[model samples]
Target: LACAFMVMSGYCELTSVSSFDAGSFSSKIVTLESIQIFTTHEWLPAKPTLYFLCQGGNRTGLPDVKKVDFLYTFNGDESWQPLTELPERKCKRCGLYEEDQIKSDDVFDEWELCPGDFVDGKYVHFKEKEFNATFACPLCKPLEEGSPSSASKNEATAHGMNVALVIVISALVSIVVISGAAVGYKYWQKKKREQEQARFLKLFEDGDDIEDELSLGNTL
Candidate 1:
């Protein structure tokens, strides 16, 4: 079967190849426009991690995709929601990761899960795993899953730190700018005063010469 799939970033034509047997039947994706797909199946509460790979006949873990004429939702939800992207851990869920779907504008962002994947700084590089664990919430996985209240607090604290740092730096910068402007203004005033004094002295000397000439003329 051949169909078009609208993913988060764009649209692609997806073809499925099915092989039938007496006991088992399997379907394989024969063609897709892009080499990779992103999925949030890993971070789902208790389910086993099915990251990025779209499997099953129903395409069960996929999200809602909309085209001009039709709309499709994964798992029958009115809207498709991609969970935060996470990598498959060794079942301990210690080092789960979340990656955003790549945007055309964000080409350079990268999280190199495999060796030899050379992603530059423009690609989003996943930071060190922010520790997640189930606390008060029963819906949370055995390890860290979902944005719990505690996680929210942690994010808020980090944000607060960032804001305070920016404020302090801004204040320091304002002080430096004001001080420099004052120094420049004072220097300009001093130079102007010196120039006026020199002009006055020249005028006074010229007047003295004129008086001397007049006195000499009178004496003659």
Candidate 2:
């Protein structure tokens, strides 16, 4: 009877983090997509209320769920609420529980919830005596070591290349401007020298003409 119950209840063994590939985990938003309870672990005429507990008794209730052995599906609406936010690089001690009027809450199952547990954006947690559940975290991902630092290094290298290109362009522009200024100055000096030589020759020719005129006057 126990074996038959375990089989019918979809029993799942506890999985460890070491079973997954080695990588750093990232934060993700978890959603309780669907759940079905095979046994409520309650007596007759029991009013079972489901809630999630994590981070040392922080409770979040699913007020709408009350039935057992019926698959409850959540639509993409207000009824489909986010369960919890898992931290990056840390596994949360979490579990599902039922509220009890006579005593402490009844635990369905307790496990260390890690981002790596989700395969292809979903994870199924099942306990033989309690319940079977499906959780969704579409954005959960495992990051390799040095990934963020590698991105920062790439950005820094690109910035350095941009600065070096700007410096080279500025140096080229300065060289062109200085060469043009030097050429213009040399041209102006050549023109001034030519003008001065022409003026001196004109002065010498005027003196020669005056001397020739004085000589003719003396002869006459």
Query: Which structure among the candidates has the greatest TM-score?
Result: 2
| lDDT by residue for model 2 (55-127), tens | 7545778877788788887752445367788876566899998888888878888997867667788889998
lDDT string, candidate 1, 137-193, tens digits: 111223243435336546867999999999999999999999999999999999999
Clashes per model (N, Cα, C within 3 A): 11, 0
Query: Which regions in candidate 2 have their CA more than 4 angstroms from the true location?
Result: 1-27, 142-220
Model 1 is weakest, by summed lDDT over 10 consecutive residues, at 27-36
> What would the TM-scores of all predictions be?
0.33, 0.50
Q: lDDT for model 2, please.
A: 0.78
Local distance difference test scores for all models: 0.36, 0.78
RMSD of candidate 1 to true structure, Å: 19.0
